[model samples]
Target: MNDQNPPAERRLPPLQLLLVSLQHVLLMYGGAVAVPLIIGQAAGLSREEIALLINADLLVAGIATLVQSLGIGPAGIRMPVMMGASFAAVSSMVVMAGMPGVGLTGIFGATIAAGLFGLLIAPFVCKIVRFFPPLVTGTVITSIGLSLFPVAVNWAGGGSGATQFGALHYLGVATAVLVTILLINQFMRGFWVNVSVLIGMALGYVLAGMLGMVDLSGLAQTPGLQVVTPNHFGAPTFSLAPILSMCLVVVIIFVESAGMFLALGKITGETVDPQRLRRGLLCDAGATFFAGFMNTFTHSSFAQNIGLVQMTGVRSRYVTALAGVILISLSLLPKAAFLVASIPAAVLGGAGIAMFGMVAATGIKILQEADIADRRNQLLVAVSIGLGMVPVIRPEFFAHLPQWMEPITHSGIAVATISAVTLNLLFNVLGGTERSLLTGASH
Candidate 1:
């Protein structure tokens, strides 16, 4: 038999490529389309306009994704990365969208400015990579998984006030899908095991259709043909306030993205040095810049989709590049876009439990290689993860802080990164003899 186990950069066969790409697109669809939905509704746009915004978002997201997976000089991570609008920038963009003078064009201007700001700081942000020893990285990665668990729970309960939230039927279906995935994983071999998430989702989609839980009403209104055009909302108009606000949001994105890049490095068995991190950040920045021209919001790695890559064990960058192609086609076909969008959140939630839990498990594995035996390191991990959970448990915990400070205080990953790096330096990097006592003395 041939040794088909090539490196992650190698392309898969065409049929397998589509199968795997579909999995990634489905996993990331909700997150990718959400920003335009929020901003469109908040701007008091008509239903048709909102729909256009969504399609335009998909178009830009597809292009951004391609840029990430395929290298462009200094841009792109050249990995299995999916691109989407940054949720971190959502609040700021929404406010900008609704502001009296700063309408959609203003939002675009700020987004473009933020993209430029991101490029300028990419080098500085990537330099922080050295500070993230496995201890810090592990803490942040574990927090990411733990924080995402609530999203799965909310989805399983029918997604943020479904009127049928917490219905037994919803839980039952999600459980069935999850159980199917587990069974396939356990009993199936090789490729079958690898595509278990896709197979499980297919079963869930069919089951939802049989039970009439899948709504197709949205498709009825969708036009047969839709197109994404540049400057659909008019040329961007830049201003200091909105631009600065977005610049701050972009900084937060950088901090969050650093964790993701490091995690991917660990996932793909690639070393994530500063230069590589710089390229990845630049790809995100370039995507955001183009999003402004294309009338969309900021772009970043679709973090949840990283879990899909981890779960499916499919690491081909070409797979994600094809996922981009599928997204572009969907953006041009509103009916098909509606069909893909109809896949219920509950179905995704079921698969998410396994995928996200694996991310936390991976962090634990990384921590195993760290100096867990040292008493100081133990306290560092404990306190850092505890701090990381504060925002997750009580999102309002930082409400008293100034508005500009919202980005830093509200981020659990940022909190963990700060705490871990601080303690590590004190306990290890700045090691004086008394450093042992600053923490606890170890065996």
Candidate 2:
């Protein structure tokens, strides 16, 4: 258990590594499964189909985590990074799901294209980060969480198409789950506090089962184990708008991941030089590009796992590699996937409220890093968020716009990102400020 000289590079005992890796896995499991669940449900897939999506997502996540934690050629960052699906891509994927003549295949097609786009730009991602400072990233992240609230609300109401939609029992269960999560975070510490969402969902599921709301039929039908294969959904169908939408998402992921990598470097006492940064960003892009053919969404480092590393003082990349192994094993168990699929929509809504709200809260926290007192910065946040809400509130606001513009208009995150970046450039960059506000200074 060496803990010196760039701690992340050290190797630990097999038993110690396994335990530490399990902790990381537990910390991220809830979030890891969330994207597939949301996207599968939004796509109107059957429970079995949704379970398959979960399997594919987990498999790709495990592979991505491995790539991030173990250097392969010049790709991996080789830090204590656990990679998973990105929430930044969710709104766009959901939009694609509902678009006419575009569904899962369209979503995957866009994901593949975005991955390639990310790889092409990985070497220059660090430069792009300046353009998306806290002002812009915060606004976009806040809008992402805000835009997805309707989906959570709908789930709490017993899913959009459920016969018992809006049933009182469903709302009650969701509220109870939300309360449980709040209480756990309030009273718990260490690992317990970290997994509050998972605990809340588990409790909600059990409660739902007692009330005859849980569906276990799928579990009986599901095989005990199943090997995940590439393109489980079908051959992806490419489209211009969806690809552009996902490419924007890749940009957001790269910017956010850059901050995470720096944070990890500080934690592990390793200097993240340009080469290391390039390697890390390349891994992120490569995993995402691989995710498309593997039947999953875009992949990025899990921020929560970084917190785990900080809290536990375990800075070994090998630990995360072990976690990747565990995730890969779990992905092979169809029963587990079916069990997760059996979780009632109401229960998921409860956890979704907590999870998605935290995303918004994270954006607000990031916004504090920006100078919000200045009216221009204030307008930057206000106008960006307001315009971002147009698509969420009125999907038809851009109906008159060219159909080709749907990539930027239909997704609120994309709209907010474009607006924030454009307005920031207009006021901060073009206003003749010598210091360049893109650097987050010289107000």
Candidate 3:
């Protein structure tokens, strides 16, 4: 009986597990913090208000990430996945913010409705997993990386088209941080190497502060212990138009999650069976609904963390669960959250370049598993990836397109998903006479 059930992998000592878990938290922190910062700024909130929003986002993200990784009953995928507010919902949110009578309440109402829509569709959406062979998944994952590259570049250059962009201090700080990460990876081994990003960021903050670049003035003004009392904004008010818009956003999220599920499957060497995919999507949808109720925005899997998971090869869902716990704790402590807030964006940019690149590399690995020798399959991958780049490279390319089309065109995920699914159907599902030489070799 003992031999029949071989012992599980030895659990690392508690300290070791905590350190590894911290690495996941560090890798995800910048992106997690950015979502709220961006949304608050765009919404024209005051500094104090923005700080409050940031804390709320972290609180919600932590809870959502935990729910995703730890799972409950049939609701979660129980993977080492982390969830956060999505950039995918940004454009629509900005649009909604401007609409008369819609305002924040409208956004909240729509998010709640959209999240429920996501929950309802989870089962049906999971069935499409079969259509996502490596070829299709590879293209979609690659598109995710391609889409995020501009974000990294913008941060590196002092953020999205800023007037003071390309300042000498920004470049110097970013370069130092990037070099620190590389040197740690090259020389440091084991756990220290795993937390290179975190260490590099700490170093960057000190260096930036010495140069009088880091701002501590905000810290003094920040509240010491501010609890995020729920219903901070009056009770949510619903509207048909806003709800409809949010539903569209939710549809895009499901499509993106489909591609992400396939990508995760390839990375983990685990099958994302219909059941697992269903649970994963439900967790994401349910999390978004939770965010709305908590006076936050939509939530989804943080694509950035997928790279960290692959790089460190720390595949335990427990590690991410621990991270979620830490995040929640931080959210409850305004002073502690402010400490993370002080980290310079340039420092974050350096780590982001490397992490995002790793995501692209994973996509490349998936492509290698694809049968590229098949000319027809080759054509499908090529076209899908190219179309996905349209929105990423020229974000405003579809600005002049119809208003109803805004939801889809503004999203690289939507573009990639549509192209991949359509082309896959054309080349694989239909099984038409137009066969490629490598078709038989694909499996």
| Model number with the top lDDT | 1
Model 1 CA RMSD to the hidden true structure, in angstroms: 2.9
Off by over 4 Å in 3: 1-11, 41-44, 161-163, 432-443
Task: Compose the digit string of candidate 1's lDDT tens values, residues 1-443.
Answer: 12364445776767778888998898888878778888988888888888888898889889888878887899888888898888877767777777888999999898899899888888788898888899888877887777778777877777774788989877877887899999998898877776788898899889878877799986776898888888887889998999998888888778778888888888877778899899999988888888888888888887787787788777778889999999999999999989988988788888888888877877787898798998999999899889988887898998887777676777777777778888988887777457566778763
Model 3, range 1-443, lDDT digits (tens) per residue? 42232111224457867877776776677777776777677767788777777788889888877887878877877777888887777877887777788777677788888898888888898898888888888888888887777777777776654468878888788888889988998988977776677778788888889987666766776677777866677687788887877778777778888788777767766678889999899998998888787778888887778777666656667778888998898888888877776666777777778777877888888889888898988888788878888988888988888766776898786798799889989877776534544465443
What do the candidate models score in CA lDDT, each in turn? 0.83, 0.78, 0.78
Q: For residue 389, what is the lDDT in candidate 2?
A: 89
Model 2 whole-model lDDT (C-alpha atoms):
0.78
**Model 2 — TM-score against the truth?**
0.72
Best by TM-score: 1
lDDT of 3: 0.78
TM-score for each model: 0.94, 0.72, 0.91
For model 2 the local lDDT of residue 221 reads: 69
- In model 2, which residue pairs have backbone atoms overlapping below 3 Å? none
Cα error, residue 307 of model 2, in Å, equals 11
